[model samples]
Target: MPATTIHLVRHGEVFNPNHVLYERLPDFHLSSRGVRMAQATARYIAAHSGLNHAAAVYSSPLDRTRETAGEILKALNSVREERGEQPLELTTDERVIEAGNEFRGKRIGHGDGALWRPENLRLIRNLHKPSWGESYDHIGQRMSDFVYEKVGEYPGEQVIVVSHESPIYSFRHLMETGSAEHWMWKRHTALASVTSFTFDSETRELLAVAYADPAAGVQ
Candidate 1:
């Protein structure tokens, strides 16, 4: 493994923060516990092995990523200060956001009249349109491209990426060539989970995947 270790950290829990569906809600923020958990993960990253060579930090454009990356940059900045170096600044890009779910911002309930209900099922029936929401294929490709581009451009320089679960997991799928349609986040990635990839600094190929939590882990 080379020094270009990419850390893919899923944002902390944002679902039902106020007991309401936060899908695509711009105002959604990390829960108090989520914030603390994110800070803890930041500390963990600061102590992690390749971060000393970190050259950049990128995040999804969503507020969740913005917040998570902010916490991480602060921690990494502290590391920079300790090492007598300049601070690490955080940058955001949209390519790392969660695969857009058609139902974003819309209410879903098992009740009779809700969109997920049989009567209004058509509201989410079209899964392939951006108008309906981004298709899984589209999201998967975008995420893969983003990862490939990152490592290809900055070989040997560690970079921390703050992203959503869908994109993060999808990148792994790209490697395994698995059926990415599966919504396996519950079984694979957990809220605030940190996943990592070590790429060959020269070829940009994956050499390993590391997990922060054994059970809620990405393979």
Candidate 2:
């Protein structure tokens, strides 16, 4: 087996006018700016010689992630056509979906919302394990499992996984430091960002992790 690279991509901004936590909700698609961001990311990946040859592409089942992955698949297919290769297929993986949150559809702000209600204070008591929603460790474990499975399935090839912010951030943290403790400041997973991990082909050990924002200039 040869060294393989897996790119964990976060989906573009969602069209949530209510500004609520749309965790795992259905029918939440990407905004107009998000569409541009997704297209920009797809173009960037297609332009990169190393990343354009993706052997497999996986995405979360959520609509936003599916839409983002759709753009990437289109770009990848275009590149493949230019190279005279077959188009790559896209797969949906539930493990890469957004972390479950108790405050789904709730407005989180400084005002008197459900997040600030006295009854919901207990949910914030354990930010480390994150009593508010899915535990950090659980999210990390699922992400790790998904990555390892894919690595074995596609040895020596580049793979892409489009997921949500928290899951990607948790996986990155867990891989980097062997811990999944939730740290507010460390959650800097930008929308439509690509966080890549290089792993040894035989040993399957992580070699390096890199982060890039293809839609950096796009507002």
Candidate 3:
């Protein structure tokens, strides 16, 4: 049996005191509240019989995602320990990394080097095929590639992947619809949310897509 399910989890809120778009830059870890959110989501997954049994855990190479994955590993490893199974290690993959953006450190409000400046306006004209940086299609394809490869590696098993909002949602949009293009503002991937995809073990066909925000109540 090939990997049947992959849970794509969005990382918790980041510690961006400056409120600038971090976008692939380094040093953006989770906040204290973000850690709590990640813990809540991790507990939810750990208590779930299926998710707790995940054979592998992966994450985007970014700090926030790795931190979120770390929380999940703690909970899952505790379950594995009780079951006398070896703990799972975290694997960082670049495919699920945050979507690149030109406005890496730009603020959103009306001030110096804001994202809405006239010069930057040209880059944001289209959200679907966004001219800013990485296109949705590319993100979707990379995520798709990572998914199918993992599916092949772990047959009849479950896997967890922690990533940022855009990559998760873009991949979900690509899976749910034929196209990855979507209204950017309409994305439903919340912090510490999980979007699970089930695939036919033998045929590699998509079986179902499910979503859950275990940390929805977290502020």
> Pick by TM-score: which candidate is best?
3
RMSD value for candidate 2: 1.5
Worst 10 residues of 3 by lDDT: 1-10
Error of 2 at 218 (Å): 0.4
* Residue-pair clashes, model 2: 0
Candidate 2 regions off by >4 Å?
Answer: 109-113
Every candidate's lDDT: 0.71, 0.90, 0.92
Off by over 4 Å in 3: 1-3
Please write out the lDDT profile of model 1 over residues 1-219, one tens digit for every residue. 455778788887553532444555687787676677677778777887676557899998778878878888888888889889998788888888766654555454555334555534555444333335566667778877888888888877878898887777767666666544544533366766778888898877678888684223221
At residue 175, what lDDT does model 1 achieve? 65
lDDT comparison, 1 vs 3, better candidate: 3
Task: Give per-residue lDDT, candidate 2, residue 125.
Answer: 81
Ranking by lDDT: 3, 2, 1
Tell me the tens digit of each residue's lDDT in model 2 across 52-149. Answer: 99999999999999999999999999999988999998899899989998888777665656467777776788666788888989999999999998
